[model samples]
Structure formats: C-alpha cells, structure tokens
Target: MGKRDREILKNICIESVAAEGNALAHVNGKTLFVPLCVPGDIVNVQVTHKKKNYMEGYMLELVTPSPMRLAPFCSHFGDCGGCRWQPIPYDKQLEFKQQQVVDQLTRIGKLDLPVIAPIMASENTVRYRNKLEFTFSNSRWVPFEALRQEAGAREVPPSPAPKAGHQSAPESAPLPVSGSAPATQLPALGFHVRGRFDKVLDIETCHLQEEPSNAIRLAVRDYAIDKGLSFFDLRQQTGFLRTLMIRITLTGEVMVVVVFAHDNPEAGEDDAARKALLDYLQHTFPQITSLHYIINTKRNDSLGDQEVIHYAGKPYIVETMEDLEFRIGPKSFYQ
Candidate 1:
C-alpha cells in the first residue's frame, strides 16, 4: 500500500450523491468521493487516491447509516458496478436525475433554458431489460466476503492451462475455491467486474433480465463446469466459450447467440463438445425462437464483421412495435 492507502479519514459526512454515483463530501476545502455510500452517511474511508482539488476513497466503516438510504436488493450491488443507486428509492432517484439535468443545463452550461420536463418513469424496475450479454472468464473474481471466510484456510491451487479444444481433460477436477492466497483461479460465466476486464464475477442470478435468461445462463454454466469445458481467458485469449447473448422481445420472441472462440486444429479442437452443448440448449429451451453461434477469432470480442451461423431454430426473431415489424438478426442493433 502507498501513503494514500494508509490515510483514513474519520467521521466524514456524505453531503450528496455525485454524477458518477459516488458519495460526495467536502473536507478541508477538497472534495471527497466515496463509493458504495449514500448521501447523509457518516463513514470512515481509507483514501485510495488524493489530489489538490479532489480525493477518492472506499468506505472502511459505516459510522452512521443515512436515514434516506434503503437496503440494496442485489447481493452483488456494490461489487458488480451496476445499479449503483439501488439504495435510493425510485422517487428519489427520479428527483436526483431531474436535478442532475437541471444542474447540467442551467447551472453548469449557464443556459437560459425553460423549465425542463420531468423524466418519465418506467412501469417496472426489475427484469425490464430486453437484452443482456454475459462473458465467459477463466478467472473468477473472488468476492471480499469469500476472501474473509478463507482468510486462514489453505491456499487454493491455480487453475491448469486450458486446452485448445472444447472440453479439457481431467473431468473430475475439484470445484474452484476462494482464499487469501494468490493462486485462486476459477471459471466464471457472467458480467465482467468493473474496471477489470480480465476478471468476471460469478453471478448466480441477475435481476436485469427475465426468468428464462437466468435459467439458461445458469444451465449453460453448470453444464460447462460439469463437462470441464474451458472458459475464454480474456488476457491470454484462449479457451472455447467466449460470450453469451440473450434477447427477449415484448412480442414473445426469444433469441440466443452463443459466441465461441476459433478452433485450433493443431491442438486437437473437439467439435463434439460444442455440438453437444448446442444440442442441449436446443432441446432444453424450446421457447428460444432463434439460436445462432459465431466463431470470433479476433483478439477483441466484436462480432460485427464475423459471420453468424444459424445453429438451430429460426435465423431471426420478429419484434412488433406499434405495427412496425422489425426482423432482428444476430447482428441487428436494437435498444
């Protein structure tokens, strides 16, 4: 740790929420930003970074919980880097967002604009998104809670090098473990951790998408783990499974796109495991209207220029928007 890491500010009161969802405070004329903290919270923070005009830190202790703060609904709320304002009520969130717009236009820009309209509220908060993308990672990010639990436990062994094929050997490999030692590597299938593209948080459930989305993701992950399928390593750019995309339309249509890394014939790439996984998905999820797969060999996870092969079901799904029918292909861009 550096000098800033050892500096702990005691009893700092968070005055407001900043634009980036950090709790804001003023200490000795310099602005202090603390993450995972709500306004009116009195917290003890360990300063991570410091500058002349600003300082940023993570909360070490919540000395006083804000009355306006509500319990976050998601277990991975603070760590996952999504839905940061979940502690604030929906009405308060709307108000804050409106104030943000007013401040940005009139106060910050010095514009002589008329009163801005109130922001529209969505009917549903959870499970309202039409699409979600999940990344497959060989190194699963170990949560702090798990680390704490395994503080004095035995050191976990590092994951073996993944083969170039679909399924690796040693099918009976022990399940991944978490520990304080540095050798704790695990396969994960979920969203990437905030600021760290190389590590992925192993998500058990995500509330952003509807039922079938979570079910399908979990099923795929479980099967992959059981079959010793290699997850794509973001840093090394190896392994088989790359990404999973699920799209659900209001017109009762579902589309699933499974992206696999390039097959290496030199290292004996097994196509049978890939076929088995696709067959399992097709047989299990009959509701999936369109199923497609792409072989993305590029270093980055972009499929814009890649060809999308239809594995099963229809090649495209239909979405109806007020009598405007749109055919959504694997590469189509829709909100």
Candidate 2:
C-alpha cells in the first residue's frame, strides 16, 4: 500500500554460492537466488521474481562483502554479464563446478555414482578462450538497482505495480541510482546477458577471449560509432551489423566472420558503409589470415542457412592433424 510497507528483503546474508553462479539464500523457507554476489555476502535483495518453491532477485545493496570474496580481476566485472564467480576463490569455482556435475548424476539421479574427482584447473584463466561470438545491440540493459530507484521515484502512491515486463520502457532508459549514472541510449557491442536474449551488456575488456579479440571488438565498436554505422536492433530487427564471430587456433591461424543484418548495395551509402567497415578491418587487423562476411536478414543473429562470402582472404584455413590437413571454413564448427 505504501513505500514503507513494501516487502523488500533487507540484510539478507547469502548462504551458499550455487553451481550456476547464483548465490543461494532462503527467505520464509523459500529459496532465493541472487546474482553478482558470493556466500557470506550480506545484501539487501530486491525480489524480481517469486514462485511457489523459489524466488529470483538482484542484489539491491551490498550490506557487507563476503570474506571469501576477492576483488574482480576484470573491470567490467558485474555489468558485462559473464564471469559471475569472479569474486569467489578459484578453488570454490572448481568445487562448485564439480559439485554441479555430481548433483545431476548423484543427488538428482537414481544411479550410484562413483567418487567424483576434483576439477583440474586450467593453466590459463584470462585470455584462455579460443573462440567467442559477440552480438551488436542498439539498446543496453538497465540494471535492477537503477530500475528500482526509478520505480521508487515514479511511485504513484504505490497502487500495486504490475509485472516488470509489462512496463513499456526501452532496455536502456534514464534510470539513475543514488551513486550510479543514468543508463544510456547508445548502442552496445558485447555478449548477450544470461536469460535476456534481447539485451546485450556492452562488454569491455572481456578476459575470456585471448589477445586481439578484445582489441578487435573495441576497435570495431569505436570505428562503427565514429563512422555512423548502424547497430542491429533486436526489437526492430534492422541495422547493418548483427554479430561478430571470431575463431583462433593454437597454430596461429585466425578466422573472422562479419555478419551484416541486411545487404543493400544499391541503397544510399549502405555499400559505402559496408566497404568502409571492411576496409578498416583489413587495414587495421593484418593478422587476420581468413576474413569473411555474411548477409543474414534472419530474425535471429544465428548463422543458420546464411551464405558466407569470402571477401579478402582464403576460403578456409588449414589445420593439420598429424599427417592429414583439415580445412576450416569461416562457417566451420570445429570448436
């Protein structure tokens, strides 16, 4: 009925970090899953979802940081959407990963499972990934904290707000929190946020992909913004750039696929913008041995049924397996 009577859970201590990177807690005997936090982290969670057996929420405020929590290595830690377990210790990550597997096999199954071995740590944490696909979005997601702040400010005497999905606000809107700035209407070039297919987080300095990945991504975004290139909008399903797919082999060969939303060469300056983007890529990234482009007007940014065009490089890169050579095209699924 009023702001003071609102049932926002405050000072909720996270009990344990789940396998899927969500911190698990219980409120009134119902499971509550929270993101961007670790076990022992005391936070005020704003419930975004409520169901019979469980609830989902975003961390409203960090009342206290977990003692096991370490400083996130990546600058885009919480915002960019991936690497949610960054605050947790490495050992904990491995433990949870193993436990997740054992969970489905042992706890949730009927089989008598064997003793599960510890997860072997990867020698490389950052810059270890060989392939990564990035999406281009015209709008960016507004975090829950800001959304809640905006909702509070816009409260019309608290007449029972409808579902969050019902409100017709663009993904990026003017929602300012006490400490953070308002979300922008600028375009985004990054990985899709988990469960939010229409939203992209605009990744900066992704630690997953190795060198030249982050560089190329940032370069593409900057050049596109500077050149007035159009980013693909999921809602309207229009624009020039759709998605970027980059694949690198250990043998030093790299393949890049530039997916355009639609191909309109005869249209005014569309061809020029396409050519300019390609020229910049060719001139900038000399290390790209295999470069290609695709014209995909499909509703989704998926590579399904799309024709790949080899623009300025080999049709396929060669990968040797002992005595045989394997051909890897721009659309290859080796990885």
RMSD of each: 9.1, 6.3
The candidate that wins on lDDT is 1
Worst 10 residues of 2 by lDDT: 172-181
- After superposing candidate 2 on the true structure, give the runs of residues whose Cα lies further than 4 Å from its correct spot: 1-6, 140-184, 318-327
lDDT of each: 0.80, 0.75
lDDT of 1 by residue, 1-335 (tens): 47423466778999887787777899989999887788888877767788989998777677788999898898777667578889888888888888887889888899898867788998998988888889998878876556644656854444444334322223221122322225656688888765567778888889998879999999999999889998998889999899999998888789999899976666555577778888999999999999988889999998889999899888999988897999999888987
| Residue 307 local lDDT, model 1 | 92
Pairs that collide, model 2: none
Error of 1 at 93 (Å): 1.0
- State the displacement of the C-alpha of residue 25, model 1, in Å, after optimal TM-score superposition: 1.2
TM-score of each: 0.87, 0.81
- By TM-score, the best candidate is 1
Error of 2 at 79 (Å): 2.0
